[model samples]
Target: MVAAALNGGGGQAGEALLTLALPKGRLAEEAAAALRAGGLDVPGEEGEQELVRLLPGSAFGRDLRLLWVRPADVPAYVREGAADAGVTGKDALAEEPQGVLERLDLGFGRCRMVVAVRRAEAERWPARLAGEAGGLSVATKYPRLARRYFLERHGLRPRVLELRGSVEVAATVGMAAAIVDLVQTGATLRANGLVAVEEVLPVSARWIVNPVSLRWKRPLLGELERRLAALAAGEVAAR
Candidate 1:
């Protein structure tokens, strides 16, 4: 069954389309596959493809508009009500948790957020960091989560250095004593002569919705949630 068009639209009979913010790059392709499995006819390709599309209303009256955007921006777009709902990584949500309801763990884009140091220093780094009165210097894309993990969990004061990308190289280049970053295969860490010392969290893609949109577009959102949840359940069963 398809979901109905959202209210408050200026298009054809004043029905607003349910807008979904999808992340660009790899996750976009995977999310498209998931949406298709859940019964929406989204594209199967990624990159340079149509970034936006409005699915014409079907017999069940489903009208969905999809927007492709940077993964880091998905939360903000949904939170600000620019899109009715979105899919983003759990890491993104953990770093900034507000203004949206995290609905489903999509079970794709799996990775581990970990603390890593050069292999030669791995054995001694923890004790050294603990005794460091100056606080531990850490490089990470997720400064908030890194600080929280070190300060609260390990009782170490962390001086977090925020980097947009290539956090793995920070420790090697002496920018920081340790680095907090995502690792899927640990290949990059090995190549950089670093090893994960502590696992902060396991992360995956998540479904989020604006609170106001949920209230106003409950029926449509609920239907989509049901279909996606069923797909996730089936995936788990197969695995």
Candidate 2:
């Protein structure tokens, strides 16, 4: 049944081929696997040196191109129409400007965006932060999310310190009152003597589409969506 859906369809001969932007990492591999399971001819092995590859005579009967990019840049590529569709985490999607459409939840790379404080200071965070003269100093990779969460949820406008990496160390090193970062297993937080106090968002890889592409290539996009959906459902059922 699934094989028929993917293999039977043939896109228009002269139609523009679709470009899919995939993140460089585990999500990229997983997305490729999913597409392959759906009968698309995605190359299984992604070489570190190569940034782009083309799958000719894909399930759509046209060249399907893949662009490997930073995970954070996937949304931008889709939004700017550099690629018609892409896979990116929900965390990245949250910080992106409101232009692209979230087509499906890919359901892999599950993690949580959380606020963590040093274990010793966990109980006093909200109180201490509220009483501080200036405001709570928070460090995070996701400064936008951290700022909005603190302001909206706690009614405290915190001074957000943006860090590209090693956010958990901010609390232990006394750089900030708390840290916001993605937690997959809580091992890193434990190792750093930090404990999660607040969960900002549950994140997973998602399929995002360009609005212009969806409008012009609805049939092609719909077929791809159906096949991917079936693959995702099978994965969920297996677990």
Number of the top lDDT candidate: 1
User: TM-score per candidate, in order?
Assistant: 0.89, 0.89
**Cα RMSDs of all predictions?**
4.2, 6.1
Worst 10 residues of 2 by lDDT: 5-14
- Tens digits of lDDT, candidate 2, 63-167: 776778988898887887767788889988887748899988877788999999999988886677778666689998887888788888998788999988888
Under the 3 Å rule for N, CA and C atoms, how many clashes does model 1 have? 1
| Error in Å for residue 155 of model 2 | 1.2
Clashes of each: 1, 0
Model 2: how far residue 149 lies from native, Å: 1.0
Clashing pairs in 1: 9-16
- In model 1, the runs with Cα more than 4 Å from the true position are 1-15, 46-48, 58-60
Model 1 lDDT on a 0 to 1 scale: 0.81
